[model samples]
Target: MAFEQPLDRTAPSISEAIDHERGRQESTLGMIASENHVSESVLEAQGSVLTNKYAEGYPGGRYYGGCQHVDTVEELAIEHAKDLFGMDHANVQPHSGTQANMGVYFSVLEPGDRILSLSLSHGGHLSHGHDVNFSGQLYDVEQYEVDPETGYIDYDAVASHALEVDPDIVVSGSSAYPREFDYERINEIADDVDAYHLADIAHVTGLIAAGVHASPAEHADFVTGSTHKTIRAGRGGFIMCDTEHADDIDSAIFPGAQGGPLMHNVAGKAVGFAEAQTSEFESYAEQVVANATRLAERFTERGLALVSGGTDKHLLLVDLRDSHPGLTGKQAEAALNDVGIIVNKNTVPGETRSPMVTSGIRVGTPALTTRSFEEAEMGIVADLIVDVLDTPDDDAVHDRVTSTVDDLCEEFPIYE
Candidate 1:
């Protein structure tokens, strides 16, 4: 299917804007932990005519007519997701991971029920009971923190907190955690308290699918994820659970939170899942981790302090206090962005600064890995970062780095 290219006279001005954005992405280093470049197949599916459908219900039970093709697409998406994660059931309808989490909360917990989760500054997500979100507003929220010294989650402390709070549900997972999670331990704690366990593996779903990360599908009562993160699918979300809770999850997602599903994104997700099932995807997943480890090692060699001392996953949080004492994460982020390397400012464990001006920066290798960058390039990228940080006021250095970045990106050539 060929998309019509707009003639110069009739073209929307947004065409330039889209092209500009794409050019920027192509020329820069994308180190955001939650971002990845999707394959052309996924993009093709996302732009397909399936977006015109209004399939308001599940397969064979739609509220609208003319859903036969959409029904097949959605069913294929669900089946592929189930096979990808080894789950008994799948629901690929939520517009985002937060919505998937909302559905899970609605499925089991009542308003004002106690819920225990990790603190956002300590690597938890906003939907995991942050005060500004509905999860905290509607439910009684108690948060656990990582150890101050080790900068890692302390299960003993988490268990103690859970026992004290006696939460109705225990949520485990994170947005920026660098180490492996102990799902079995979390499950045991939840079992001891007779509480439900919900694991939001949005960031690590691709790794889990590729057997690079531990699988929570077998242990957690409920699992939620975003398809776009490491999965490299189009924008969408999904939920999986034990077959016993399948009906409740379906009801919660459909009638409780969202209406009709985006069949186009679902189709894209199906394609991503099928791709993930291949051996090539496994190699990509392994390289993602390898690149991340190499980056972490480079940071250490350059005298940058890493949170939790190092990373065991695709992302690492750098504590800037040691290398650039007075420079906030906000400043470092801006400086990197100026030189075409993108990353987000984030709070380190026990941070004294505000979220807007955090103490650390979160960096990842997924997008770079997706562009086929290897461990050697990771070291060079780290050196560039160190040099930029060391000479923030030098435009010559920034200009030179930006030129080099453009050349490197040209070699990688994303979306060709």
Candidate 2:
């Protein structure tokens, strides 16, 4: 294998781009709600020689040769995931979170099965049932939205809609929602309609694992999550189900939805899951919520309207329609980027703008918290973000914010 060779010598372009990305991450403040920094141990495992192997089947059952070592890695990942999330079975082979959802859908659903999920504009994910995604193209999808006045999902409304639709499956999760979900209530609703409950905890997997946020494992029939975002695991996905559906879920992932598993990334997941069990990780998760709370408080005090008013987890959805009328989320994102702060524009409840140019920005604290940022630092970052949004055209403000961001980045280096 040429795996031991240096990338700079053989693929300079790719190596240069990788270097640039590291530099960018080290220099800027990453506030994107769905992003986080993984540990160096995870980085090493993901970049290991296992990437050169082909692990086409689950542990102790292989369709290919030389899978013995990789099988150990996969088994460790599976066991750790099962222990971490308290699920009876785990399939850590889905290439991404979307594929994880696809695997679960393929296992139990036929074409055109009805799906009831949260609306995309109101903080739901594309994989839940968006028209453009395969989930929607293959399923009959109906959406539920948050209350326009309170900016929170009304459980009564969800139950009413579920009764009317009688869906085959009820999805409980979101991408930009700022409040905790009532998973028990949703599971009960699914029961009333005789529908399966699938909980996609991709964005809050780490928080749930650390016990900072409530877990959906006991309430939902199926659970799916991303390995990278909040978990700092790696760049892959996993599915959790009861033993009754374990074999079905594994086969769905292997032959039904995907091919060979990314064994190296599975190794990363194994390493990250081990790290996440530490007491420090619990405190880190707690600080993440605290920082987000402080940031939301500062935003509200500065007159920025927050969807759901504040956050109960790691992220906030700021609806800019009232505070900065005529200014689009795209503009706010660019202005913040100019000041060395990174965030993504998102659609809020009752969104009127197109997906390309949304009316809100989704900010989070997991990445900053990984860098050891606390409530005081989050307050400062919030002020900087609001200042940029308040005066996007002020050159002096840009320069000042840029300098402060540089100073903060230097003080809290991501990789010592």
Highest lDDT model number: 2
TM-scores, all models, native as reference: 0.97, 0.99
- Model 1 over residues 1-416: C-alpha lDDT tens digits? 13465643356577777788888889899999999999999989998999999999899999999999999998999998999999999999999999999999999999999889989999999999988999989999999988989988999989998899899999999998899889999999999899999999989989999999998876799999999888788788899998899999999999999888888899999989888899999999999999999999989999999999888889999999989998899999999999999999999888899999999999999999999999999999999998888888799999989988888899997888
Off-target runs (Cα >4 Å) in candidate 1 are 1-11
* Candidate 2: pairs in clash: none
| Model 2 misplaced regions, further than 4 Å | 1-5
lDDT of 2 by residue, 1-416 (tens): 56668999788899999999999999999999899999999999999899999978888888899888999898999899988999999999999999999999999989999999999999999999999999999999999999999998999999999999899999999999999999999999999999999999999999999999999999998999999988899799999999988888988898999899999999999999988889989999999999999999999999999998999999999999999997899999999999999999999898999988999999999999999999899999999999999999999999999999999999999998
lDDT of 2 at 316: 98
lDDT of each: 0.91, 0.94
Candidate 2 lDDT (Cα, 0 to 1):
0.94
